[model samples]
Target: MNQDKRQILAQYEKSMTWVESLADVTEEQWRTPIEVGKWSVAEVIGHLIPWDEFVVSKRIPLLFTEDSLPKAPNVQEMNANAANSSRLQSKEETIGKFLNGRHQLIDALHHLTDEQWQHSFHIGESELTLYRYFSGLVEHDWHHFLQIEKVLK
Candidate 1:
């Protein structure tokens, strides 16, 4: 694999380890919001599960194909439901779900050929390469990771 793909895959692998470590944190720390009126650490991690599933099941199959990409999901509803689920579940359960979903995404991405990484596809009116798409997701992961880390500290 190229450096870019390696980097993305490494981030995915690193995320699993990072989240697994959160299982050891105190419940109060796990549930603390990163900022006033924002999502708690658990909720922030919880929200990632469905997004990974969406990328694996919905986004990957349609990309680089003749078929049109599906419409975007309702962000508010999906996020609210995920956050609620996180709030109701144990920290271990929430982290387990996140790890499972992320593993599935990593597996799907591993199957893609190097050629596909560079292939451009249109999402609605915007065109982007698979590498770019995954790169954006990695950036999203870092954004949340920082939020959780801040709250933990």
Candidate 2:
């Protein structure tokens, strides 16, 4: 409900508007791999799930239960794993899962207090507040959304 959290939620809402508005594309379109080379729409959606899940279900809880940020996996390695994940899913299933995870992220952001938003955590060598993490999520959404749009074209 603070300004930072409000801004993050607004950004997410806007992004979701685009994500949710995408419709009528054939399954072939969704399964078409593009952008990050081997990543299809299904894989992109699959990739986003753990990120949203991490922010909502993992990081937030760690803010209270643990004294520090949880150990993060290597970014390059994780992307490699996503690329290799054979469970690419159907268009409907991928989109539905993304929507569900996105809603959970929004709900989690809505509940954060001002202090929590200001709390600092380190990712690699960079220190970030909760708001920064929210911004990162927004960036992540847009990055993949553009990839999806480009592939559809």
Candidate 3:
């Protein structure tokens, strides 16, 4: 595989492994916010789940078709809802949902042809590639992982 594909696969691995690393977090810690008015550790992982589904169901498929991409999701409301909805879940349930979505996304991505790695699509003001879009999610995963760490601290 090319460098970009290697990087893409690496990110997927990193995202899953990073989450798995947190499997030992106590239930109390899962609900505690890393900072005031920020998402709790569970909420943050809940938020990450939809982005993966979006990539698999919307973003990835858009590349192989002529249809226009859907408008971006409402982040603030989505975040709020995800957190609220997941608040009552057991730690295992929350983590299971996250893992299911992540695996679904990774599976969808694995079927892409080499040419699809370089596939381009427009999002808002920018034209971006499949590789760039997925890489951004990797960064997104790290951003949350860091937040979860700070909460643990």
User: Which is the leading candidate under TM-score?
Assistant: 1
Give candidate 2 regions above 4 Å deviation.
Answer: 64-66, 74-88
Better of 1 and 3 by lDDT: 1
Instruction: After superposing candidate 3 on the true structure, give the runs of residues whose Cα lies further than 4 Å from its correct spot.
Output: none
lDDT of each: 0.90, 0.73, 0.81
> What are the clash counts of all predictions, listed in order?
0, 0, 0
TM-score for each model: 0.96, 0.81, 0.92
lDDT of 3 by residue, 10-118 (tens): 7887788878776798888988887898778888888887777877887777766778878768988877788887797887888888888989887887788778777
Model 3 lowest lDDT segment of ten:
58-67
- Model 1 CA RMSD to the hidden true structure, in angstroms: 0.9
Model 3 TM: 0.92
What's model 3's overall lDDT?
A: 0.81
Compare the candidates by lDDT and give the number of the best one.
1
Q: Which residue pairs come into collision in candidate 1?
A: none
Model 1: worst 10 consecutive residues (lDDT sum)? 2-11
Order the candidates by TM-score, highest first — what do you get?
A: 1, 3, 2
> What does candidate 1's lDDT look like per residue over 1-153, in tens digits?
966677789989999999899989999998899999999998999999889989999999889788988987899999999999999999989999999999999999888888888778999888898878888999999899988888787
